[model samples]
Target: MKLILIRHGETEGNLNGIYQGIKDYPLSEEGKLQNLKLKSKLENINVDKVYYSTMERAKKTADAIFDFSSSAIYFEENLSFNEINFGLWDGKDYKYISKNYSEQFQSFIDDFKIFKFPEGESFKDFYNRVSEGIRKIIKVSKEEDNIAIVAHGGTIRVILCELLGFNYEGFYKFNISHGCYSLLTVCKDSAVLEFLNK
Candidate 1:
């Protein structure tokens, strides 16, 4: 099976360097253009299905691909692929979080893998959610099927970590840029990254 992992296009929160988490924000004008370009690039690829986060940005990005595909593709919104819930930090900039929640911020920086955002999910929780989603995708897909996943940076990183056998703490190693797609060749026992941040 082939997996195409895509990060949603930019939003005002992204441009402003804010943590969007589960907050829903529409794509910025620049983001729309970016998705258009991505759509054109993927028009020739034969995609079998598209699984996107429930977030508006992810939905819009998935729509870009589905709308231009030559054949009908199965599409579904999966909440498990949604961005990690940031709790009170949602829509807040790093500066604000550091200033307002200094101790918690420091703890997060010290060991983010175990740090649970106040009123939100821990990294472990997020990883499990994304991993389950990936498991379902793999189980339902045929060996030759090409599956596309449209989600947030964090969500995509978690998926990559799960597939590539990386520790959850190493999720940051992947740089999933907005509107970019990474390809992976996956099997029951092993997975190989074909390309990243493309």
Candidate 2:
């Protein structure tokens, strides 16, 4: 079976550098157009099913690509894959965070796994959330199908870690951009990355 992971189109938080966390936010206007362009780009692929995060941005992207025409289109909250809860930092810009809390900002850049944003979650917590969704996908998918998942960048990084056998500390090295795509082929023993950030 093949698994395709796609990050949702840009959000207002993406453009503004705000920590969106698990809060519900719609896609920006440019995001919608980006998703439509992505749909046009992927129109030829034989996608058997489309699965997406319940977050509006992700769902909107999935709808643009698959149009919910196949019964295989599913919105899974588990797949919504929560962002690292930013807590008090949720609405702050990166520049503000870096200037006011230099050490914390450096921790995020230098050692994300250990960076804790006051009341927010650790990277480990976010990793496990994506892991659960991965497990579900592996158990349910047929050998012949190509499954597409529309989720967040954080979620895509976890999928990359699992598929590429990357250690916990290297998660930040994988850069899945907004509206970018990845392809993972799953066999009996392990998963192989075919394409990344395409």
Candidate 3:
């Protein structure tokens, strides 16, 4: 089975370099352009099932690609792969969040293994959520269908690391772009990364 993992197109928060975790922002004009580019790139491939996060950015991007098509599109709350929730820092600027919540944010950056947002879920918790969703998707995959998932950067990284056995420290190395796709081909018990950050 072939799994195509796509990161949603750019958002205002992305261009602004803000921590977008789950703030629910829409795509910017540039993001729309990128999405169309991706659509053009994926044109002839037969995509059986399209799944994405419920967030507007993800949902909208999915709609763009899978729109006016016969494919079954599934939106799942579980697919909303988000970073550690910033709690009190959710909508604030990153610099402000760092300045105000310096110690907590530092710990979070330095040793994410132990640090978490003041009132947010831990990295372990976030990883478990993505893992559960991945297992479910894998179990449901058939021999012929091609699966596409439009998800967040955080989600994509977690899935790649878990499925490919990449070390935790190397998790951020995936470096995916907005609307870019990463391909993974899976068989019974093993999977190989076809292309990453494409």
Query: Please, what is the whole-model Cα lDDT of each candidate in the order they appear?
Result: 0.89, 0.77, 0.79
lDDT of 2 at 88: 64
Error of 1 at 37 (Å): 0.8
Candidate closer to the true structure by TM-score (higher is better), 2 or 3: 3
Q: Compute each candidate's TM-score over C-alphas.
A: 0.96, 0.87, 0.91
Summarize candidate 2's per-residue lDDT along 6-113 as a digit string, tens digits.
Answer: 888899888887877766577888888888888887888888767777677887788777766556555454543645577667778887888988877888888777
Candidate 2 stretches greater than 4 Å from native: 72-75
Better of 1 and 3 by lDDT: 1
Q: 1-198 in candidate 1: lDDT tens per residue?
A: 999999999998898999999998778888888898888878788988888998988988888767645467787889999999999999899999999999999999999999999899898898899999899889978999999999989988988888888968679898889988899999986899999987
How far residue 67's Cα lies from its native spot in candidate 3, in Å, is 2.3
Query: Which has the greatest TM-score?
Result: 1
Can you write out model 3's per-residue Cα lDDT over 1-198, one digit (the tens) per residue? 999998989998888877777677779999998889899888887887777776788878887877645635444544545444656766678899889999888887788866566676777777778877887888987977788888889889988887887746657778888988999998876789999877
> Backbone collision count in every prediction?
0, 0, 0
